[model samples]
Target: MRFPGFTGEWKETTAAETCSEFKSGKGLKAENILSEGLYPVYGGNGLRGYTSTFNHDGFFVLIGRQGALCGNINIAEGKSYITEHAIAVQANTENVTGFFQYLLLNMNLGQYSDQSAQPGLAVNKLLKLRINLPSKEEQQKIATMLSLLDARIATQNNIITTVC
Candidate 1:
């Protein structure tokens, strides 16, 4: 989707150009999980635990590598700890916007998914796919705009939950 109020091309790019190495998170057992920690849990599609150890920092997006939620998208700020089933995408922000990249991924890639007895994202298909482009400035602005709406909606939902 094109960002309004900005007129620029969304150049198509392969995932290879837009991303670096995709790493998987370490597997941690639920029974051994520590309740108090600083790390954020990343899993197939949800959190399994937290840990103090980490591998990457700053903004990064994650995609489920296997399972029903395969191809599911998520983003994190600061430091994070993801699970083994998720693949990390370090955005090619120099050529695109990170937030916009995250938004763009949500459009769905199930068709490209490598079907198995168990479903999962086909890395081979996913890694080479191209996406329409957006300028970093416009991407940031669009991401911010969407983020504010999301925050507002979440707050409203919280308020409603509390009232109920």
Candidate 2:
């Protein structure tokens, strides 16, 4: 469960312990999203559109709170506005990297989602979900590796688009 060169067992902790804040986003309607706005507006499925104002600043992990994609994870950096369909996980960078936390969340959140008429992720239940925290260095290493892979994937996708 850890990368090479890293020793010691990872510590068990709840999501709430690592995250400094967890709250559902403020209500933002589809009509409010502007195409030529200053800030990106995030919903359950990621960037829905743009807006003129923002409610959150800095880096945070956004988890989809409802719908079939409940438990989906996305990262919001700098100034952005999150809507009611997602919950933000704001972790202190000193302890955990936002990207690493996002990967961990996406890997384990599916089981916590309620599969009722409308699929949903309850914040209280999500906060209690267990997580294994690795050393900061290990986290950085893993995140860097994943980010590099993501960049490669994006490049391939762009090349495919251009060829088509």
Candidate 3:
């Protein structure tokens, strides 16, 4: 669906074209994980635990790369450690990070996983996949709206958790 005042068709591009970096996270052993630490560690299933060291900082989208949950995506921000189980993606100057997060979330990447005992998403295959993109202004508008909605949902979930 097109938003009001947005004209022209979205440009078609591959993930590799829009992203500056698409690579796997560094390895972090299970022993390194701590119940409470300075940084959060992200794995295939997300938020595996916390750790003393971090491999990533700033905002980026993480895609699960192995196991049954392969192809799952999550947004990571600030000082954090993205384990080898997740592929980190950073949008280029032309695109908004939040916009890509929403786009990847809707993509249902699980379908692209390799059919093995433990499904896995290959970084190269994901990079080659085609995606549509609107103008920077339009991307910002859409991402802001969706992020606000996500915040509201989180708030509601917190309230439910507290009440119930």
> Could you say which candidate leads in lDDT?
3
lDDT of 2 by residue, 1-164 (tens): 66778997778887778777787999987788988789999988899889999999988788889988888788889999999898988766556555445555557676678879998889998788777877777767877888788889999999999999
Deviation (Å) of 122 in candidate 1: 2.6
RMSD of 1: 2.5
Alpha carbon lDDT of residue 160, candidate 1? 100
TM per prediction: 0.84, 0.89, 0.94
Against the reference, the lDDT scores of all candidates come to 0.70, 0.81, 0.92
The order by descending TM-score is 3, 2, 1
Candidate 1 residue pairs that clash:
10-133, 11-133
RMSD to the true structure for each prediction, in A, is 2.5, 1.9, 1.2
Per-residue accuracy of model 1 over 1-164 as CA lDDT, tens digit each: 56668887777877677666556666767754566678877776756667776656877677777877787777756787777788777766474346644564676855566778888776667777777657777767777887788789999999999999
Instruction: Show the lowest summed lDDT stretch of 10 residues, model 1.
Output: 95-104
- Sorting all predicted structures by lDDT, with the top scorer first, yields 3, 2, 1
lDDT of 3 by residue, 1-164 (tens): 87899997899999999998789999988999998999999988789889999898889899999999898889789999998899999889999988999999999999999998989999999999999999988999999999999999999999999999
The CA-based lDDT of model 2 is what? 0.81
Q: Against the correct fold, how does model 3 do in TM-score?
A: 0.94
